[model samples]
Target: MKELINKYYQNHSLIYKVLLFLITTAVIVYFFPKGGKFKYNLQKGKPWQYENLYAPFDFSIQKSPEELNAEKEEIEKSKQLFFLVKEEVKAEVIESYNKKVDFILKDSLALKMNKARLKNFGEKFINNVYKVGFLNKADNSKIQSNQLITLRLGNEASDILSDNLFTTDELVSSIQQYFTNSSYESLENNFTSLFFEILEPNVFYDEELTNRALEEELKNRSFTKGFVAENERIISKGDMVDASKYEILDSLKKEYDTQLWSKSSYNWIVVGYTILVALVLVMLFLFLKKYRLEIFHNNTKLTFILFNIVLFVFLVTIVQKYFVGYLYVVPIIILPIVLKAFFDARLGLFTHVLTVLLLGFIVPNSFEFVFLQIIAGMVTILTVSELHRRANLFVSILKITLIYTVAYLAFSIIQNGSEQKIQWVYFGMFALNGVLSFLSLFLILIYEKSFGLVSDVSLLELSDTNSTLLRELNEKAPGTFQHSMQVANLAEASANEIGANAMLVRAGALYHDIGKMLNPMYFTENQTTSVSPHHDLSPTDSAKIIRDHVIKGIEMAKKNGLPDRLIDFIRTHHGTNTIYYFYKMQSELTPDQVNIEDFKYPGPIPFSKETAILMMCDSCEAASKSLKTPTALLIDELVEKVINTQMSQGQFMNSDITFKEIQTIKKVIKKKLHNIYHLRIEYPE
Candidate 1:
């Protein structure tokens, strides 16, 4: 049944197409009624007929002519009043004009009749006219009684016209028109009483009264009343439309159609939404498929899934918030880290490319960010690819930062094509982000530490030359220290030959026999000039005591927070191998009563290449020290014997050590052992 499901899922393209067809059919079914209605309405001149069909109520309102007539009468009254004021102002203006003319003529006549020095007479005449306020100010005194009487008789007209007072025809016309028009209106309507009552002398001085009258006139004007009446018509609801209630009903109907999946627009929206949702699922499935292979091959658990999710979310959020343009490209940094933590650099490179493509869908931008990101990510991966120590992380980050700077500058120049220097601000920001990438590695480390997930880098750090525990071992147990150093060289060489992490193997070597520090003298290698502590004890007691060191080392290691990778090497180094020499010695002394298992070093056997190498190196070193007539050939023979014995006993079975790798390890061990066991020359003294 599982196989059938798997096969069916494997042919997903056909299934997806069928699903699409079914969804299209459903959408057509749902929208058929509404689509037909829309098409019918569109054929008519009322495409918005649906809105009209749903309208619920009506109201009638209109304007009457009487109201318009009343407004017009008010407008006429204001106009009449305005004209009356205008005519009165005109008469007053004419009167002021005549007075000015009379004053000017009288002044000139005085100058001519007196025959006083005529020098500057015109200037004096103008001055005297202005001083009397004759211009627009009526001066009744300037109109002489004799001039009035002469004008009434129509006599002396020629003489008067020739005189300087009446030298111009304009002066004669001014005087005659003012007196005739002004007296005609004044006498017709008791103008003095009307002026005092309706147009007070202080009316011109009363700004407030003038403003109020102007405002009243404006209110009664035809245009203002017409505008107000039009506004009333607009405000009054008309029978043509209860548009507000109609709009509400139309909106509710639209919402109902949408809810029932009855609209064609809804179908399109659903299709688009479906496509987006399907794409998201497809992306998730692709991610799972890709990583499933890795997880299966590695025998990893959900922690890897959790870790990747964390990495994905963290990287996506960072890209979204800080570097929107580079969102797609910037997340490639996490690819190298994920690869290094979970797999290798080659896999990291592959995943980096995959991440770029995935992010391209998420973040749309110019291709330059993508190119720069790929370059930066590749540089980061390559730099950290062979890291063997914690310090290498810094070097990798620094190198990546430099590469990113150079790449950014080069790409910036290529893209911008200007003489302006690349901004250090951008470089600084990129460097800061790179540093953040470096810090993110520490987060991976902390996760690895908390979860007991051993990686090559973490193992290397634990066994580094600067490890405090290893240094302490060297100081406290020099003999064990020397032994550890020899084992480290052998293990590192063997590991390098077998395509394993040499630094991890070397570091593991330096602390593999740390258990011996607890009971150094019980072991042959640490026995200086002192008496042997195990001599008085039975072989079983001595073996038990020796076995206790492995247990003690684990406790000590735990107390110091040593990583489990190093601890594994210490635990499995002996790997159920026997104390054959002691067992043999005891078997000869008590042949029938001896139990072979009693003389064995308690172990579960080597579980990894590093531990297997440590086991071989430890045995070879101990056996090499026992050789009395040491030679390169003897050392090689003994090394091969120890390796074969371990192999025959199945000590290497659980480890990843292959037969070909074992042969390479043997050759390396033979060379190193030969150097250590080479005989010293006896010179002639």
Candidate 2:
């Protein structure tokens, strides 16, 4: 039992990878929307390719959107709008008119005789205006004269022509017209002024009541106009889906998707979703395991990849639930852009395609959505080669947006066949998706800090020679700084030749010997004087100082907050090779007292191509500087000897560098060194 536990602990990494995939699969399944899918792909104007379709049960035929919209428009155009009558305003006007009418009339012997007639006329005119209903003149333009509006007075409501209502201006005109035909033309001004002063609008448009009435009317509108009985054949195979056939099939599909099934059936649906989602995740696992074993071995990176997939899936699910019209606005292309930034284009595109395939089950128009996202993802991987340049990302976004718009447009044209039926709103959605894709830059920064991973953009920033750490190295150890620069150039060139990470290797090379800054004169390159500090110290002490620089470098790098990837160079540049010169001196002086481990570097060795290249370049570049006079043949011999010695000592045993790549690197280093020394080819004399 103890041995079994130990065995489990021993293979924990492999076990963790298995659990990682399983957990991710389960999480994705949880995010999968619950529902049954209609087993047919519906496309208007396409032939029914399946067997004769029959209604499983009696279901209503849902009206098409166009049909429902037409009904709504007709109702909106003819609906009776409500206007609430202000009975209080009418009473106030009547009461104030009686009080103010005397002000308009003066006592005259002839006027007194007609005073009763004038008072009666004034009361009748006021009553007539209010009875006809006074409305604001500004509202007249919104409703047509013949349009019907319901006038609600107290508890009673009556529909009337909008033209029947009197405006304040019309009331004045009517008073003047009445005076012109009668004998009291001189009293026109007085009557007009008095009535106008006392009159107030007593009717207003009741938008709330109008909306309630409209809703009541709409309640009578039926969503379905017809019903198909059970066992009725909806369409025959190979029949072109005409308008009538399309509606029945669409209605059946809606009913089928929304219909509740038994628990056993729902569980089977869950099982189906699980199997499909698991299959996709397994394919992704196999891809990583076969083609990207390094990333596959790293649980953090694999989890990052899986997290992105699930994150986008959740985003798509939410959008589909609430904002289905803007489903394309989710920035599906961000997956490939982010993956390509941290990894490579092939892996980015592969993972993106699989993710999009998973989303097919959730988004509408599955084929079109998958095609558009897959194409856009491919364009993202192809166009955005360098995340270090912000301009490149912008340009890639534009290209991706263009691809999305063009692909979606083509699909629309193919399905609808006419440009008139195309939904142009999707173009705006594609543009929004592109804009959101820029969020990947911000997300990349977050991922770097959160996951402790590195990207090309970060590597590029570190490669700047004027950065804080590199600047400090230059000030304290100028020779070592210059040496690091040469090694950076050599490592970068070799990495480019072997398809390795050029930026990463260059950044690592610049900071590899930063610990030499502490004791600048102890290193031969940093020493300016002819006398050596080592001459005054014992060989054991000197060798100890040399071996301690690696440890010191790691400490300084961490204090400066450099990425762990670059710190690997500091740890493995010398690998575990012995400080042979000082060791030999110590052995000769006190052969009985020497311990071999004290003179060796504490190393984990190079574990990748970039680190292996740095190991080779650092040793070859530093060794080449020691030659009194460098020739083409001498440089070649030094390069071969340095790299061959590292190879024999098993420094590169953990790294994946090939023997051919090493030979190529040796040639590149020899050429770079020769150029540094300005060596010329010798002619046969």
Candidate 3:
């Protein structure tokens, strides 16, 4: 039982990996739509490639969105506007007019006119004008075409031509003619102004009632004008899918997705989703295990990758359910951009394609959506390869947006065969997608902070010599600072030649020797006077101090908050190789008492191509400074000896760097050294 527990304890990490894989698969599967996928790839312009297609169940043929929108637009144009006539307003106006006339006659200069006849004619005119109804000015501007409005007077309603109604202007004309035929032309102008001021539009636009009636009409609007019985042949093989046939196929697909499945079939559907989603995630895991073993072994990085996929799938799935129109605007392109920033383009594009394929099942028009997104993902990977460069960052974003828009445009035109028929809203979606893709920059910063991982952007920031830690290193140990800079250049060039992360290696190289600052004078490079610190110390003490630099560097780096990745270079730059000078001297004096382990630098060795390159560059750069009169040949020999010695000592055994890559790095170092020494090529005749 004890042995069994120990065995389980030893394999806990592997078990954790298995659990992570299962959880990722389950989460992705849960994001899938709980419906069966339609079996056919339906395209409107393409010929039917399958055998005679038939409806398996009875379903109404749904009208196309364009058709439904056209119907609604007709209703908007031809709907009747209802107006109510207030019968009480007529009586109110007459009483108010009589009061005004009585008061005006007592003070008027024209009191010789028959006041009773004047009041009677004005009352008669008001009844004639307010008979039909007058429209308010606000509603008049809405309808420019011929309008037939419904006028309601209490419980009675009647349809009347809008031209028959009297506007305020028409009332003026009628009043002029009435007075021309009467004996009251003396007060015509004054009464005309009074009539205009006293009268209000009795027949108002019944906006509330009109809207309710419109809603009732719209609610009764039929989405389907026809229905197809079960087993009806929809289309035959090799038949062109015209508009009518396309509508039938689309309607059938919608029914297939929405119709309730039987208990057994639903369970089967869920099982199918599980198997497919699990397979995709399995492929991702296998890819990481095979190609990116370092990341596969590190659970933090593995979780980071998995978390990104799940987060995007969740966001896109929610959008698919709630805001279906904004599906394209969900910014799926950001997946590739973020992955490329943290990892490599190849992995980014691969995982992006996988993620888009998973989403293909959720979004409608799966083929077109998957095709467009895969292309966009590839474009993202290609352009965002150098996201650390601020100039190239916007350029990449613009290129990604342009590619997505142009591709979507071309696909739309090809599918519809008419640019006018293309749904222009998708163009806005694509533009907004581009805008949202810029969020990848902020997302990267968030991931860095959350996951304790580093990206090229962070590496670039750390690479700046003016940073606090680097500035202190320069002030305290200028010689070590200069050495680190030279080593950084060499490591960067070597990394570029071997297709490693140049920025990462450069950052690693810069902070690798920070421990030398603690005891700067002990190192030969910082010794300005003719005296040496090691002269007063014994060989054992000297070796101990020299080896303590790696330990001290790691402590200082952790204290200052450097990433574990950069700290690795400080730990492994010298590997476990011995400080041979002090070791040899100690052994010569006390062969029996000298301990080899005490002389060795504590190291786990360089465990990656970047760290291995730093080790080689560090050793070669320091050794190069010792040459009294250097030549290209001697520099070449020095690089070969240093790297080969480290190689024979198994320093690069765990680094995963190949022999060819090592040879290439050596050649780069030799050439760079020759240039630094100003060695000109011997061009002989």
Model 3 Cα lDDT, one tens digit per residue, 207-250: 88788888889889999978999998999999998778888899
Q: Per-residue CA lDDT of candidate 1, range 586-642, in tens?
A: 888899999999888678798667788888888888788888888887888898899
Q: Which parts of model 3 have CA positions greater than 4 angstroms off?
A: 1-9, 47-51, 93-131, 134-146, 175-201, 237-244, 260-268, 385-388, 464-482, 514-556, 571-607, 622-629, 638-663, 679-685
> Alpha carbon lDDT of residue 610, candidate 2?
91
Q: Give the candidate order by descending lDDT.
A: 3, 2, 1
Q: What is the C-alpha RMSD of each candidate to the true structure, in Å?
A: 22.2, 5.9, 5.2
Highest-TM-score candidate: 3
How does residue 647 of candidate 2 score in lDDT? 94
State the C-alpha lDDT per candidate: 0.57, 0.86, 0.87
lDDT of candidate model 3 versus the reference: 0.87
- Which ranges of candidate 1 are over 4 A from the true structure? 1-305, 317-323, 328-331, 338-436, 440-476, 497-499, 529-531, 589-595, 680-685
- Could you tell me which 10 consecutive residues in candidate 1 have the lowest summed lDDT? 36-45
Worst 10 residues of 2 by lDDT: 104-113
Worst 10 residues of 3 by lDDT: 257-266
